[model samples]
Target: MEAALTGSLLSLSNNLDTQAKAAQKDSQALRNISYGILASDKPSDFRESLDNVKSGLEYTTQYNQQFIDTLKEIEKNENVDLSKEIDKVKAANNRINESLRLVNQLSNALKNGSSGTAEATKLLDQLSKLDSSLSSFRDYVKKDLNSSLVSISQRIMDELNKGQTALSNVQSKLNTIDQVINSGQAILKNGKTRIDRLQTVLPSIEQQYISAVKNAQANFPKVKSDVAKAANFVRNDLPQLEQRLTNATASVNKNLPTLLNGYDQAVGLLNKNQPQAKKALSDLADFAQNKLPDVEKDLKKANKIFKKLDKDDAVDKLIDTLKNDLKKQAGIIANPINKKTVDVFPVKDYGSGMTPFYTALSVWVGALLMVSLLTVDNKHKSLESVLTTRQVFLGKAGFFIMLGMLQALIVSVGDLLILKAGVESPVLFVLITIFCSIIFNSIVYTCVSLLGNPGKAIAIVLLVLQIAGGGGTFPIQTTPQFFQNISPYLPFTYAIDSLRETVGGIVPEILITKLIILTLFGIGFFVVGLILKPVTDPLMKRVSEKVDQSNVTE
Candidate 1:
């Protein structure tokens, strides 16, 4: 029993250590992502990062609660020291029997005519001592140990209950937020549809106005000629005819130009304002269709997390933050700008902003393809005779890194030659792409090497996340909170940022920072691969064996 108890403790301890390490890794990822958020100019990204932080906190809380539960179970276990209690009871029984035997000896001595002897007195004293010892043992069990156990158990239960209550409160708040988002989205969707229809018919309406003005101008000459002939026929009132004719001609000149000029001005104003109106409507639609839904999804995720946690100030704070951000976003969408006029400097290349994003995406996609096609392990060699796991990982990593660099070169050079990306610093552009490739390949390679097929799935998921959250295409702030929160953790964010710097015009400090971040990401994933491969390899092997067995059965 003791051995089993010790083993359970050891297993729990190991589980805790693993959980702690996982949490630490998550913390570092969150920190890195937070930094990415700070670097971003978009509010959407910042809000999204906050959501990720909340999720991490909730997970950490659940882990801590698991530790608490383990401790509580250990404390509440009545059988934990049952063996010790049995041993105490047995010692007391032996003493009681010895006392009874001594009493019998005294009786036998009295019957044998030795009642006044020292032996009888000694037996009485021994009996007295045994009685005292048994009483002490009984008191220890009933009074001291029992009370202590009860007190410990009660304390653990009290704390656990408190935690559960806190979590429940947080869950309720999140549900409320979800409902609010749903309502807001429905309202915005209707508004966007209406705006779209209005924009679609606006050009036809303008054309009708132009046709009416032109027809009026074409008939004005005949009306003036008819009036002049009337004045010639009315020679009896020459002065009045001259005055009337002058007045009529003056009215035509004034009214015709006014109508034509008004039409031209209206057309010009509509042409200038149409794009801004469309942009405002698009922004609102994006918020309703994309941003709000994402926020709600994140809230639901957070709600799931809170379901496992205790009610605490942290949960309250998280809910409040989410609510405030959602309210702000609602306001922005509701009060969208119809037209905004601002002075701006125009860049020669309109695509410069997006070039970095596409370049990074191409390089990442290339690495993903490379890893998917290639095997990380050598199947020919027996497991015992093969290279160390680290060696296999590093070896495969080196090959993938080279391939990634080549892919980067091909894509980057192609962008310059064919796409005319008009990169300001061609050398820096290629260098950034190479660095991005290394980072992307490292992440994909690490996953595949350590986790096998499941790792590949994770890599694919990561790619999808980065594409959405990386701020590569649209501003991260313009995206949903979940993507915004995850963008900083994604390598694509730094890669694209660095690429954009190279394409637009490099800021040496910013460029250096981005490059350093990308390098860290590569190093971080490589380290994860090194640490987790040995641990996960056996599991993967077991799964493979299970699959093979199932296939044979089929």
Candidate 2:
């Protein structure tokens, strides 16, 4: 038992590592593609692109090794399960899906000239071929009676070989694209050098013009100077000299614009040519295949070992183990399942707490407080002297609504005090929080008017519900379908969503909707409460009797 547990733990650990590596590689590949596709703008995004590419590659290799290792382990087992094999196949398919997703992302980045379009496009094509081949091959293997173990092994081997060939061809295509990107980068650098040189000359030309102007002025006769001196300077020396400097400066300025334009045109041409090269790589990768020789060899071995078992039951057990291993691997590709139940705990309203928590609390607290304060006596009411049924019900609703507003003010003030630190959308955030509080107040009041103390129990129920549907942490959609469907009906849910948006830089429309809903709920409850007040006399008497017993006991 201990050994089996150890094996399971080890397997899980490897699976986790594989996933982490795959994620890293996917991110790196994205960065590399960005660099290749957007060669012109690579200087700015180059670091990110490169980092993503390297990380993605590392992760992919790590994940692939783990997968292969797991497969080998399952192959070695004497008793294999068909279900386990199916699971493993599914896991492999999931890995393939991830690869495909990464490829697609890279292709998009390339098409948009992100970083490494050619390489990304090629990788995408290779991934596509691998997916198609695997899909068909897995189906063939599942048919069980397609051929003898040797024949099936041969077929798988051939398919895997095709896949590896595709991988090789894709690598070649990426190399060509890389060359074009490097060449383009070189040309871009040259253009920058030329532009820089021209920029350096500009200030000198301006200075030269200033000097010529000063010399022309100094040559001119002053008010006290002779007429002949002034005339000589003006006609022969100053006019000619001033014109020379002015003409030189103007000529330089005029040529600068044209020179810059030409440089820009050249850079644009290079960028355009780069894309064509990237496309060529993508086309080449499309022609390649994705095959695994190891996989085929392992399959052959497993099948041969299975055939040697004389008893059908022993063969079945072996087959079951194989199938189980395969299925387990496949299941790993999907989102990790959370078997742990939701742990309900007290949520602290730390100023940094998400909008939903505050909004929901505000609404529920306000409604109940307002209603309780308005109708219920501070001291105990007994059989000897009890508040009228009408007073108790309507009064509680009114008091809670008012209390709700006061609570809203307190929270809003708190927000204002810390708004600078974190509250991004002050107006929207406060409004939504207040809106939710009012709605919660209204809903609680309505429930109390109908069921009295039993309604307080209903508030508790709402609290549990809000925790699940509030989208405070777990997104409502990811929960059970019933919660997902019913979430919108709860005012706290909308309020929380709205407040979260406001705080998190997402402006939600639910705040306004909450207000509308709250108003409607308030009106409906008020009307219902008035209608029920006369009929609920008997229930009110019983409540008074309970109140007397409590007071007497105290």
Candidate 3:
């Protein structure tokens, strides 16, 4: 049972390590794909093109209405209208905005990295159809709408001198309209090609990801059941083994007196039969003279042995020597092993070891407090027209991040300067604390900034999970399977790990790794906060309305 249990533990540990490496490799693929998709700048740049086209179309419709009003003033005998084509142009620009929105959704999905392959692929399909429709829309606007506007422009220039201004206006708007449609044409062209190709790319990405997850679970499945069996043996079956050992000793003691009595009885029977055996040998000797001579020789041999036994009691002294040797070495006979323990990087005390966990905890709490108290949004009514949504979020976020960093500074510095927790590299410890603070601040602030109240809830839930699975006070593997599984993704896992390094001794490789992962987490959320503020504005507004109605909310 002991061997089985130890083997099961080793297997689980090895598989977890292998799985971690495989996950890292899969993360690389996800990183590459995310970079490729996001680097295209489809959403940001296309929004610019979309804005240009939308504005141009609105201007064209406004001027065309003026042209119609002027024509009505002069042409009482005739009816001249171009509203249908104007409406078609307007409708095309609206459809183009739909494409813009789908691209935004695709870009946002890409930000989710490998976890969002299905969502990204679904959006890719939608965008492909939207792109094709956009191409047709641009064609209609370019050939049909532009020609209609030109015809009206020429008729006004030729027949109505008073409508000459309207002709020039219509002609300039037509030029603007054609230029915008051409821009849309280029966007749709590239968008269609990329969206179609993304489907193939997604499957390859998903395959690599699945391969990563599968290839690393070598012994985990086989040993997973055995681990429980071993645990059961130790818990419920171990006592039976102990009882057997006890019963063996008790049985030896209980039967020892009876066994000694049987030995005495056999000796007595042999003594009682000795005289008869001697008489029978005498009778045989009478039958054979050679037997009598042999008996005389045997009697002489027995007398020689008795004379030897009397010589200095040598046999009894030899037995006494063996008993003395046994007394000297009896403990070794019962138990024969010595064990030595070594702690290469010893923590000074339990509190010193727990310092890392508490320090990380303080940083998280600090960041959480800042986001909860201060609004992530500036809510700047005066600057509403002057600033974009991203700008407002970023500006307010800067202040909240500052507060959170100061909180990290106070807690980490206090732990060293006041608590006097054991630390090997105080500078790195302080820096890491500040770094975790920035990340926590970004994550929490971004959540609030993006989701209003719900984001705070998310941050709180993270705090709860990190506290349990952070591998701070207890080893993460010793925790429940759920916490063990989530342990890697917890924000504080790396934080506490790195802190422990600083507390005991630093491993450069480990420090650098934790540095990279923590930074990635921080920057990932920061960028998301920057990119998604505009996208979430409508949702925020709706949430804000509900909060306003529920007078209990602050």
- Candidate 2 residue lDDT tens string, 421-518: 25557776666566556566767776666666677678778877877776776777799998888787765665665666556555336545655665
Of candidate 3, the 10-residue stretch with the lowest lDDT total is: 70-79
Against the true structure, candidate 3 reaches a TM-score of 0.42
Best by TM-score: 3
Q: Tens-digit lDDT track for model 1 on 65-184?
A: 554543443433322433443345445545544544554454454445553234435544664565466456546545554454454444433433454443344345444543444476
What TM-score does structure 1 among the candidates reach? Answer: 0.38
| Candidate 3 segments exceeding 4 Å error | 1-336
lDDT values, one for every candidate: 0.66, 0.57, 0.66
> Between prediction 1 and prediction 2, which has the larger lDDT?
1
Q: Given candidate 1, what's the lDDT at residue 49? A: 46
Best-to-worst TM-score order? 3, 1, 2
Clashing pairs in 3: none
Off by over 4 Å in 2: 1-353, 362-396, 418-421, 505-511, 546-554
